[model samples]
Target chain A: MEVVHTIADLQSRIKAYRRRNDQAVGFVPTMGFLHEGHASLMNKARSQCGLVVLSIFVNPLQFGPGEDFERYPRDAERDLAVAEAAGVDLVFMPSVSEMYPSPTRTTVSVSDVTTRLCGASRPGHFDGVATVVSKLFHIVQPDQAFFGLKDAQQVAVIEQMVQDLNMPIEIVPCPTLREADGLAMSSRNVYLSPEERQQALVLSQSLQIAKEYIQSKSSQGFTSTELASLVRAHIETAPLAVVDYAEVLSYPTLEPFDHSHSISSLIIALAVKFGKTRLIDNLILQVRK
Target chain B: MEVVHTIADLQSRIKAYRRRNDQAVGFVPTMGFLHEGHASLMNKARSQCGLVVLSIFVNPLQFGPGEDFERYPRDAERDLAVAEAAGVDLVFMPSVSEMYPSPTRTTVSVSDVTTRLCGASRPGHFDGVATVVSKLFHIVQPDQAFFGLKDAQQVAVIEQMVQDLNMPIEIVPCPTLREADGLAMSSRNVYLSPEERQQALVLSQSLQIAKEYIQSKSSQGFTSTELASLVRAHIETAPLAVVDYAEVLSYPTLEPFDHSHSISSLIIALAVKFGKTRLIDNLILQVRK
Candidate 1:
């Protein structure tokens, strides 16, 4: 696999791939930390297209002033090895200056969908996310782009943007990969202390419990309010976990649905803090018909 | 020239063009009235790109209440003839439903740039302009997109957005096309009554006087206050013309600039109403280095 250090080089390579006529480019954009989740996105891209391009750009604009931008994990050597193992055709790793030459000002924002969830916590967060993703989309101009369900709100924002802008690429959203303990894999997970990491397991553990509760129609079965309360209660029990948000949002819209729409393929998304580090995670809870 | 009615078709055509190794795609996005101004944009696109695609979408989002959305003049047959005459590769004419599907929710806005000129007269006007332009840019994904300098502030806003978002597309700003009488060409010109149409010349004439005043180094030459008064006085002299804005703005940034930036360009852009129809015009004076 080839490693590209500049936007121009990456764009030229993709431009050449397009010139080949027979090759289909599949893209996976990640903030490289070399987790299994990132690998799964690459695998999905690999399975779908003749060539896979993975961009590891830890975009600063997407993070809020208080967010973990300066300390965002970077493991380029390991990330490259993972990409090479996953059969990535090219790895695009652009610097901030390469991605953004000064006098840069444009932004792409999907309107209403961006007003809630993570957007609710960090203002201009989705705008930053949407704008950067749009830039990557144009740069890659892929046949298909892969995103994980872990960043459920992000997927929604991108999906809405592609649909609204009439951008011509298939947005393939894959299931979020998890660790053995069901913790949604995230780069920020490394920020957690060993004890805090153990406490963070309450996040995914509660979702599994909720899933079973709904499927079995147990006494603990939840309405939207009850589900939120149940999740909040479990996180509250974790001394190290200071929950930022614990809510069940409708699939795709990320809107706070009353109990009605929470049953079929709902997303249990949340953010929690272990000391100064904020970790986000989600579980795709399938409610049995 | 091919006519594409759907995004799917445009994408395939664009893909095929890519497969053939055509690197240049220049776009002229417009609302169909087929005036010389639009032709000028297409001409630029034709000169610049290997393939030129023109879209005539009378974007509803850009039109305000009491604005001429329903009454906006459209002549697709005439527009097609004009586009064909201008050497365009494709004319994309999508239905309103196609551009704005229900549940459509995305908006792109530029700060302060939208706070004046037409934006001042028509609330949410720039918001509309920004949103539609973003949509068009995404759909066309052209290497260079052409826009008129007649709407100088709009140009600045778009440039800001491109800079902020790191959009890879080049924005080509064309000089505003005007009638022999110096009135700026616009689709809304069709809405003017014969007398109102004749009176519309006062707008361009006022700006011409301002230019002459500045060039001749009249005592009021360098004073923004004096230039604004001269423009306003000329427009007000014609009783039928209601001045929407008559200000001298530093070109490109549209910020108030005097002798500050030695080589900065200045644009005195304004709009007026001859009867109820709004007309816009501008004079961009590139300051000597």
Candidate 2:
């Protein structure tokens, strides 16, 4: 229930929590416009950890030049309420200057896993995410960190980074939360007009169609190309929907599976533009042996 | 001292040490061969910390293609003896496969500070050093990590990386230890022939010349170009010495100081080739305001 703005204050609070019996801290890092997705992560942390730490910083590093860096939503009061409700022990909301005191010269980058999907569309985006998450991980020094599979590729990238770097923390990935209508929850959903909001359903709907197709015995031995085509054709049915990318690749690695081999684990990822708002959703599935 | 090869073993040992009264861990990461410079770092760690952990990894990532990676000197028995003598509590000597079981997909890189000096001469060298050191820091989770100022630019890059990432560890830069003949201590020093070793003294000799010149009040307001020429001229006196680089720049930053600004702290760095052996040395000086 304590809120802190500076890194020093947050560290002191975390230390105090640890000093009083070695607390198992869980961290949930977000760009703070608390939707059901972020809250789900926080609630998961609260359930499993002794102390839950939530960071709400609209990271400018993750946005491209013409992207929504400036227009990224902020709702500190609402976010604080949500954090309190989720039983977060500490809330760290640092200023841009406080997080990045100077122009950052250091970068934490993961290759292969970051070359496709959202990473392909937004260059240097995952580097920014990786760098910021690295800074947050160091600052929080938590036992486990929760990440929503809403940004599935992000979870993959972060997991790869942690494994490759031998970072002493666990990455607990939570299921992506969805609306009653099946639309994936995201802060950027607020950017959609009423008509655009309705059209965005094509994203999750196409993912569902792909999921059913993959689950069907008739769809056995389907190549990535065939699966991608099925998803793309379905999304194009929406007049307002413009398919940015519809990719069917190996999960986490994001690499195209060999057609000669049977698929084991796969992810069907989509990014579609409904007006100026670009929405993304994905479904990870495991094929039966 | 207990020697561990697997990361799991090291982590378990470190955890046990931490569990008992919160011991302050000190880390010394090196490429083995056990020179006096490394001993100095270990000695410093031994005196200051409750437990000292030493890692001997001749990181392949730091060496350029066609460089001396295969020929990199290592002496596990001697290194173990040296660690025991220096009072190191744990020695982590992971095999190449153990350290990098898979191709490293993640890279920790620092810009600006890595763009000059050895970074320029050896491409991707700092990235390798940065990545491995990052891995070691995470695995050990030491209170303070010791590094030799013999590799001054490396110290700067690591310092920058630690600051940027907010790594909860201190970087202790130990002074460069040298041979009685004035050559900087390095594992690569074993490559030098007797005559080449004699000529290698020019690397440190020139640093001494620059240090003396900078200290003599007459050298006030001297430009980097003037300082470089004076040192370069002295280094050229050695018959076998082929000056690879002899430059003067601002300490740590490695950027050239502007003539309009009065110099406060500066580093004169040298890299010289004697026959096939290459040696490097540097001197950091503070001008009286």
Predicted model with the maximum DockQ: 2
Over A1-289, each residue of candidate 2 has an lDDT whose tens digit, in order, gives 9999999999998998888867689999999999988999999999999999999998989999999988888889999999999899899999999999999999999999998989999999999999999999999999999999989999999999999899989999999999999999999999999988987888888888887776674545667888899999999988999888999988878888856656677899999998878999999998666
lDDT of 1 by residue, B151-176 (tens): 78888888877766656789989998
Error of 1 at A74 (Å): 2.4
For all candidates in order, the CA lDDT equals 0.82, 0.90
Q: Estimate each model's TM-score.
A: 0.92, 0.98
Candidate 1 clashes between residue pairs 3 or more apart in a chain or in different chains: A104-B163, A104-B164, A105-B163, A105-B164, A106-B161, A106-B162, A106-B163, A106-B164, A106-B165, B251-B266
Ten-residue stretch with the least lDDT total in model 1 chain A: A256-265
By summed lDDT, the worst window of 10 consecutive residues in model 2 chain A runs over A214-223
Q: Score the docking of each candidate (DockQ).
A: 0.59, 0.92
**Collision count of model 1:** 10
Whole-model lDDT, model 1: 0.82
Worst ten in a row by lDDT for model 2 chain B: B214-223
